[model samples]
Target: MSFSTNQARIRCTQLAPRIGDGPGNLAQIETELASAASDGIDLLVLPELATSGYSLTPSEARDAALPADSPVFARWQAILGEHTSAVIGFCEHGGEDPSGVLIYNSAVILTPGSAPTIYRKLHLWDTEKSIFTPGSDVPPVVDTPFGKLGTVICYDLEFPEMPRSLALRGADVIAVPTNWPYISRPENEHAPEVVHAMAAARASGVAIACCDRSGEERGTVWTEGTTVVGTDGWVTGEMAASGRYDAAVELAGDRRRISPRNDVFGDRRPEFYEL
Candidate 1:
């Protein structure tokens, strides 16, 4: 897709419930995709492990994994092609090496003109460590119908290096599919994940579109701040509650001019940070 110097828009969805109900989840996703298309959004992002929900046992996670040849995946790819570029998460079954793990936590990218690219999550939360093995390689900054795009899973965003690595490698926009819980904290405290994403955006100069699941699942409640933060450290768009909702914003591109005054990348000195 050709990119113009003009504004680039992204629409994010904060999806709720349907955890582990594949058919029902697809219906919800389809409905939202149709709505976002009507709104003329260029891209749409969905939550983490949306297909199977979070907190599944290793066996359950493997059983929930969908094959690449499945109609459900094809249907989603076609839907994404028809509307806007999209990023969606699923727990996937990996290759059968009897000696290896059977499932992986992955985010799949689908655009109008290209084959779907899968990004396996490189980091795993404590519970997940028992099931999915860490991803072995990094995904490239994919060129889609929208622009250069990249993806990360739930816990991956907590570390600063991941997003920064993508930006320095040429990603213009980073799509994060997370299942963030809203555990009660002190009144003035922010969710640590929220703060992590904000700092990542400011440090990388890349637009961040994060979609986290909402509502209770397996006794855990998901936090309710699905947002799109720009490189300028501003919340360009946000969806505060659960259920299906969309947010659109014009994302900046990689062609931005380099300047010393406000150039976040230019001023960094890697040499002094070694500890």
Candidate 2:
């Protein structure tokens, strides 16, 4: 497929959200949004549950949950520049009744002067099942001035089909809001989750920005693996001393073409393989 060549400055801000501290977390996010706007970032990605933090109990999750129409989103929108957009994860109050309240691990894409486009996390991690309801809808690909941005949560990236599906749907960049738990790995090796992200980017010929969280929560340490992978499947950005990963990547153009005669998507033989 052909695409117009466009450049975008992307930043992944790794934050340390305090568990259950909604006010404080919002303040931190607001500050970052202002800074991103000032820095001329076209796409800013934030860690999952950035507003409520990870490691929350059921009641804590509910307490931190915000409706999709929360005024805080508008506040965030006001802070963003005309060319800057952000994707942030938060606990969502899906619904409530006499039986119980539904909560979701959700991410919202905020564009200046536009309604927020929210995506609930379809795949929950190990303990997340106990607190959040898995999303039932497919991820959304939103059109922006920079490019078509696709949204996915942390664990959702583990499913190779997720990024592939987004690419098939014409996504230019995939913004992943993740909170990766620290896992042991061989020295000098990328974290397993980052490896999965890299492979996904290469296989789909799409750029991917994964924003991982920092700091420990409830005795669990974070990998702090915030990274950006280019269309060619190479690590283009890593966390800097400021705890942010920044990169200027191609948001447009025919990245699927690998060789003069070979195109990554064009060479697929789906008819013979059963997924």
Candidate 3:
């Protein structure tokens, strides 16, 4: 289907990233970039730490971390098409900070004719605390020709405050690069990670796109949970474990009211309750 200028064509990739294999991982990212252009995708979101892989040892994380101006980023910038924007995950070096880990698990947003934007993971998972530092900055709601774009990493979406604030700040679409792993669940149900994403999308009246990886890293298996949720809380498109999934999402900033009398934001009673 053809997308109008107001509609955003988004794609997510589910692929296994080899741990500490920078060159191999970069090659995979290059292929995906070409694929995104071929698919005519407007926004492409890749899995968390996709360029460096997850489940790395502390030393491995340090070895994989790269400066913000690394040649790999320059390469990605060079290959991106005019209208396409991409979000990819990597380990970032924290130049002279004395507190916290010297590395951060971060995502870089690549826009056609602009400098890249960086977002560090605020909510650290399992062994990640030992390997990277937590971010303290508020994730930005970027303004682009395509839409009001926001982004958060895997665990960050679990907190309603994250998406709610982004939506309140005029973000109509949020991109998530996750590393969801297998956990105990019912025989035929979706992963909890996806459930959280859907709920966030519907509650905030925003489009949410996620990219999750496949295959095991350091004996830890991933859920391969790739999905896109519309503002209505229902999923648009997703592939099983490998491949690209596309969705034409409508991010209407003016459609927040449930009815003529009830506004999604106007009904808020934040003064009565406190965080």
lDDT of each: 0.75, 0.90, 0.84
Clashing pairs in 3: none
Q: State which candidate has the highest TM-score.
A: 2
Model 3 CA lDDT for position 49: 94
lDDT per residue as tens, model 2, 1-275:
22334877889999999986899999999989999999888899999999999999999999999999998998898899787899999999999868699999999999876799999999999999989888999899998878888999998999999999999899889999999999999999999988998999999889999999999988999999999998888899656788888988875477888789988889999999788
Q: What lDDT score goes with residue 43 in model 3?
A: 88
Question: Which lDDT value does model 1 have at 7?
Answer: 49
**Model 3's lDDT to the true fold?**
0.84
For model 1, how many clashes? 0
Task: Compare the candidates by lDDT and give the number of the best one.
Answer: 2
Per-residue lDDT of 121 in model 3: 89
Model 2: what TM-score? 0.96
Which digits, one per residue and each the tens of the lDDT, describe model 3 over residues 1-275?
46766678889988788987988998999998888877778888999999889988888888888888887787887777777788898889877565644799899988787788889989999888888889988997777668788999999988889988888898888999999988889978779988888888877788899888888888888887789998878899656334787788876655677687977788888899778
Task: For model 3, state the Cα shift of residue 112 in Å.
Answer: 1.9
Worst 10 residues of 1 by lDDT: 240-249
After superposition, the stretches of candidate 3 with alpha carbons farther than 4 Å from their true spots are: 99-101, 240-242
Using all chains and alpha carbons, the TM-scores for the candidates as numbered come to 0.88, 0.96, 0.94
lDDT for each residue of candidate 1 in 100-218, tens digit (9 for 90 to 100)? 65688888887777777888899888878888877887865788655688899888998788998898887778999898877677788667787787778777777788888877888
